[model samples]
Target: SGDLRIEMRDLAVFGEESERAARAVFAAGKQDEYWDYHNALFEGGEHRPKSQLDDDSLVSLGEDLGLDPMQFKQDMNSTEAHEQFDTVASEGQSIGVSSTPAFIIGGKPLLGAQPTQQFTDAVDEALARAES
Candidate 1:
């Protein structure tokens, strides 16, 4: 449960929108080690990017991360991983969220890429409300 992943789905970064680096991260995500790819992108943000996740680069990165190239390839095409990811997305959509990083805390909605302080303050308030 302590897994962190960043997804860039439904994207077609070709032509004028050829973000090869960004696409590479998404392509890497197709593998089980997408988290590594994501963290790498974040760490190297703007310094050097792929503009899109090319297959060759994704494979190379997975190998660089010490992931079994074969397993990573298999997992990428495996229905199990995609289904698991899709289930969460589908559940979120059913629950009135169409965007990313949606949350439910103390029965209240906290949506989008909110700051840590906002969540911390909300949780603190929620605790107070529960106490009262």
Candidate 2:
């Protein structure tokens, strides 16, 4: 239903490595394993260093996940993936989303690490707006 709408955007706010990591996720998406790849990157920990998301590690992770290494590499460097990531990054920057864990609810921007109740309140606010 229209209860909620969630969208994932790639904004390379962390640095070059962050951009590469986002591209890797986009590449995995081509193989229908975006979340799998994304989760694996974060599996080590939430504060996974940029080295962990390097190109070699990303390709290796794809191999571990049974994705064809060659195809994964190609998709990871593909123009389409690059453009998709670049577009989202630019759009997000334009909208002042220059950090991780950003959210836009009911046309209001919420940034940084938020508590559970904050999200609940955002949702309630959104629902209330819809009703009015």
Candidate 3:
């Protein structure tokens, strides 16, 4: 994976609850535990239904990740986190993304949950372009 650099952009296409959870995850990044919280959110399965990601669940996930509960709560509700989420969400929209799990690989849009081979092909194509 050394040849690949992945960046996550949180999009709030789901709704307000989803937006809040997304912001909380970004706030967790401030504590250097983004991936930990991220993994915890999806720990039980490959995909979690939106109904299972309420505000209380989000905070609990943070605490389970050993992030300071009070600090995490404050950060999750902070203006900074809201703004950061907004910025990324807007950027995703500007690029014509209108759904969850949309990916822009090598400046090409790959929408939805794709097969593993599709990802490998995209990465290989991108690598070739980079080398050229």
Candidate 4:
């Protein structure tokens, strides 16, 4: 096994519907299908011409994932889910994350599309710091 751990955070900056997507994904997380929903959104984002981040589309996505349709909508529209999205977005902004696909390795940020070797170097440096 490896010591590497990966965590995803919400930073809604893509479009008008991004905040809606964030809340929907948060709701999915509550049902323990966070990564599945997250991955589906990302994959869909790449191919879909029109934005699928609306409430109806979000609920449909949950239904496809076997989540309760009504419950998913309820959770997605709940005040708590919105607050959670706001909190994470605020936290990311406080830490200087302002864009999609940003990475923070060892407390140092790597912003925007980067090469694989760059990530390798960053991880190696992070591991070195941890070991030292």
TM-score of each: 0.57, 0.91, 0.83, 0.88
Q: Give the better candidate number (2 or 4) by TM-score.
A: 2
- Model 3 spans with C-alpha error above 4 angstroms: 46-52
What is the lDDT of every predicted structure here? 0.56, 0.86, 0.83, 0.86
> Taking the tens digit of each residue's C-alpha lDDT, what string does model 4 give over 40-85?
8778557333457788998999899988888899999999998898
Question: Mind giving the per-residue lDDT tens digits that candidate 2 earns over 2-107?
Answer: 7998988767778888888889888988899988988887786684687777878889998999888999999999999889988998888777787888998877
lDDT of 1 at 53: 48
Question: Which candidate leads in TM-score?
Answer: 2
The reply for model 4, stretches above 4 Å from the true place, is 44-51
Q: Tens digit of lDDT per residue, candidate 3, span 26-80?
A: 8789899988887776687565677767767788888888888889888998999
Model 3 clashing residue pairs (backbone): none
| Clash pairs detected, candidate 4 | none
lDDT of 1 by residue, 1-132 (tens): 322223344222233133344344444665555668767645654433443345555556667887677766566445654555556556555666665456666656677889999888877777778779
Order of the predicted models by TM-score, top scorer first: 2, 4, 3, 1
